[model samples]
Target chain A: MSSDRIAAAFARAASERRAALVAYLTAYDGGFEHSLSCLLAAIDAGADVIELGVPFSDPSADGPTICAAMVRAREHGATLTHVLSLLAQLRAQRDTPVVLFGYANPLLRRGATRFADDARAAGADGVLVVDLPPESAAILREPVRAAGLHWIGLVAPTTSAARCELVARGASGFLYAITRAGTTGTALAEADSDEDAALRRQLALVRAATRLPVVAGFGVRTPEHVARLAPHAEGVVVGSALVEAALAGPSVLGASVRALREATAR
Target chain B: MLRTPVDHRDDDAPGSFGRFGGRYVAETLMPVVLELEAGWNAAWADPDFRSDVARMLACWAGRPSALSPAPRLAQALGTAARVWLKREDLNHTGSHKINNCVGQVLLAQRLGKRRIIAETGAGQHGVATATVCAKLGLPCVVYMGAVDVARQQLNVLRMQMLGATVVPVEAGSATLKDAINEALRDWVAHPHDTHYVIGSVMGPHPYPTMVRELQRIIGAEVRHQLHAEVGKAPDALVACVGGGSNAMGLFAEFVADATVALFGVEAAGCGLHDRHAATMARGSEGVYHGMRSRVLQDDDGQLLEAHSISAGLDYPGVGPEHAWLHECGRARYLAVDDAAALAAALQLARSEGILPALESAHAFAALPEVLATLGFDRGRGEGRDVVVNLSGRGDKDMPTFAAQLLARPETP
Candidate 1:
């Protein structure tokens, strides 16, 4: 099962006294075959878990870099069905946990149960519906869990304590801890002591709420950032930076992923 | 005064209009939505809050705005039907937008929010929100699409003059939908101190319900005005539907009246078959910007960019209530092309000396056709009264009007 794989990956990283490197790449971003090759390259370059972004028309939460990737992927004729087919192809070669990261509209249009079934059949380990809050999660949770896929929840800097508890209770695989209070691709103020203190504080709050591995994401660009955030999180997710690299081709993306992975090593 | 009982049953369940409206936002925004919903409900139930809103509407917004009889317009159309205009164009901000803005600003104050944020398409809502925020001594920020800012420069200047910071959003078609996304992102970042004054009745939860409630005053006043002047309800109520606030407001009181037919006009940019903003005419059910409604989207659930001459009506989605109204057969929706809307605006101006906003002109454009369909003619002598919601004055649109009508007559 994908959830078990995610748990085991985190466990192995913990034993090695290092954080797990979670790499995010948009499916079919560089055309069907090239994007698949990019995913394989990321996994080979030491990405412990893979997050496959499903390109959306309006990615409100995304920053410019990811938005550019979406535009490119759309221009290349990437659709939800195409992404699933690519995932199926990738699953044939690797057992690395793969999660579909996207908005709710497409999944809702596809019908929640049907999407969960298709995703599981395509060898997806988990699903992170970015816009689906806990209040509306019932639309997908039962069907996803019943299909043996993890329903990951996101905790933001603005999330209240009570809501944090709810998210922790419902979260599967791991909780995604957003480091800042803004959209993805926004630069994190790693140089500012005050900003770093606040991020640490938020990370501590998220860690206290759940025993499951908490992965920190958003604005994580350099190895220095990964090193700085490794203590507070069990896993670090690098998205926009790697996506930018993938734009230059899989070779560049592989080197970038390897650098981030090496930075996670204690 | 025959006052109909306001139905609370429709909004009893939070964030739902049939199966349409729901809190389909990010988890980061869930708590804020719940908090805002609680605040709105408490304010709604409190008599003090109700009176406060009522007092502000009357004294501040110059409301109980006149319902003027448009005899000249009716005569020019060669129809025997008595036509009355609900003069929302006379409101403080020269538009019906002030009604929702004032109420929301008061609600934000009651909720103890010190800062206000809003998303605008044509800049009417931005100007309205900025006006209210300035009056209440609250700092305001308005997000407008870069494209909209370019087209509606006067409204942008108006908002700026009212002491609000206008941010130009440059993402995804650079229109109202993009502005909304930017505003939502801002709300997510500043959920504690800031209140998002959504311009329309199309967003998630409390907004559609709350904005509708505030706007219901339009219909309430029209009903009273018609009853006093003509001793009877109008045969029909007509308003243009963008995100549907004006139409919902005008239709709120009359929805229960089986005798009154409600008509919502959508902007058909060129025509229904061409680029248009007629969501109900050629749209499918999908979720976008927190509500499940009839939306203009591709087969893969990607939102398609809507086109319209009137910036206010250029949206891919309609309000949940309008969708429900169309589905249940309570109200009828029709599309008016840009050329027809422009012609109606010119006709009204030339005949009655009332230059209507392009958005309002859509309703006027559809009037003659709807009247013909209803079998009202000069020979019929029906004498059936019809009320058209003149939603805003066209002073701000003078540039577009001059550019389209005078500067270049032959070209669209």
Candidate 2:
């Protein structure tokens, strides 16, 4: 995938005011069958992208909800290969872009090149190895490029411009900007003045630092947040909100995504 | 009085101690880790916060345990060097480990974290963590190496008595590393409400830096004590280097003090020549538990299993800062064999009426080197004063010591 194509995809989505909902579900969140059903169900619920969580015993940064889900997934015998197969099944049924989210251990355990090749072949468009920040991209970048897969970067509220520049220089695909200073699966009460201003400033800084499309995430549970963050970012990636919606039931997910989509469209 | 660089360390906010520490974890975790960095940085700047922590240290754990001058102990070794020992051993839990445990648990409470998970080796740290958890009314779980659970049975019982769940980890040599892995797994699963109170100055990013900062009180007190008594700083600062928390704490204030040489002693087990774990003496660079540092590994890059008579020193990797220090020549690492360390433990018991933990004995054993290098004859007063950190009391090791002493045919 060319960088231009990724940028164009973000531009078109942004201009439509259609907030893209990125649904995150660990393959085997329940079991292989239930996970596949959930993946297809998420797409039917208006998920623009599917973030496939590969189960690893260790997730250095994830909070309790996601970590418990991952541990359950692993206990149910889910592996990277299993997740890839699930993703392939999703691709066969739909055309949604899939990004694999995981820590560095599993990827390192499998040689980077081989892991990238396997991921691309399994129908993944991008991979977010959670731990590979700007200072530590040497282990992943080249192989990801070689395998024709995008290496997505995550920028936090605390990332300084210097660090962001370094990460953006090497990043491909859309940049993921965290909304808060905490872990995944939880949202803070609306961003305070300091936090909101920092988020806006970081979004703007990240935009200037990289050519890639930037998507803001973390604690984005409502349509108001989607609308609020839309104009400032290339897109808004909703993980916990969508997962929470799915947990509330498929109807709730569809309703939430539709509401977000309508809000972003404005 | 010697001028040190703790003042210089103030310039690096978020993380950095004169090219020593910085955030090094991956992007996914950066937000949370950075938040912790900022919180801790701010905490350090607040005098009220420091005084509150200090109050806890003094009243709860009984601080200023004792800084007795060991002239007899020093003279017998022929260094004529005045050795003032800081009795961290008298702390509530009988080790310096409680100093960090109390500090970190307080931080967790401040952050509103309800559960605490930690890893332990000799179980001193586990006992410390458990004791704090019980005191604070927080849920605590400690992961212990299966091997350690067997060896330190009393500590295991103590942790249970303190209402902490002890999980025996059986993977990867079934030792401290395995326990660390299990604790990390638990943390990842409960990050929102749980804090992994790392016992030592190791782990990824904020942990190594944060834990060391908490342990820095050891140095801060030493600084004030040294100035009040000796009219000048000691010539050399020495401590055993396991995951290096104790040494780092004792040496933090003295790092940039050009006159005071910092020496870290690693356990050589039988000897450096023996198939032993000696990261400072014979290990290579490799990444384990998140950062690249001196690791005991084989040619193919497989981590060579480390061995030490002291369970705490059996870890294969040293802290990254220790690696950087070794590289920068700011600190020197010496190795002590098991016999030497054991002998030191016994000597301290007989002479000073203080039994030193085998792990702490490594620092005591390195005293001969201090004598030889500083041009101090055992009979003369020509050398500088040496401060050896009595890291932990030998209470936990009484069973091991008694058994070993009884089994020795050469013992009277």
Q: Write the per-residue lDDT of candidate 2 for residues A26-139, one digit (tens) a residue.
A: 667877777776677777766666778777654545665676677678667776677778878877887778888876656655668988888888888888866667666667
Instruction: Quote model 1's TM-score.
Output: 0.94
Report how closely model 1 matches the true complex, as a DockQ value: 0.68
- Residues B1-412 of candidate 2 have per-residue lDDT tens digits of 3334444442444334444444446553455565555666677677877787788888888886677788778877876678878777888898889888987888777777888989999898999999989988999999998988888888999999999999998765778876876775565445467777888877666667777778887877887888889778888888999899998888877787788888899999878888566898998765556665677865424455678888888888888778767766778889998888888998888779899988899999988886677666656545467888999988788787878775798876
Predicted chain B of candidate 1, TM-score versus the true chain B: 0.96
Model 1, B34: alpha-carbon shift in Å?
A: 1.2
Per-residue alpha-carbon lDDT of model 1 for B1-412, expressed as tens digits?
A: 2222334256566767677788788776777888898999999899998998889889999998889999888887778888889999999999999999988999999999989999999899999999999999999999998999999999999999999999999888899999998998888778789999998898888788899999999999998999999798888899999999999999998888877888999999989999999999999898889877899988677889999989999999999888888877778899999999988999888877898999999999998877886677553436688899999999888988888887875644
* Model 2 chain B weakest lDDT span, ten residues long: B1-10
Docking quality level of the chain pair in candidate 1? medium
In angstroms, how far off is B300's CA in candidate 1? 0.5
Candidate 2 - chain A - TM: 0.91
B412 in model 2: Cα distance from truth in Å?
2.6
Q: Every model's DockQ, to 2 decimals? A: 0.68, 0.14
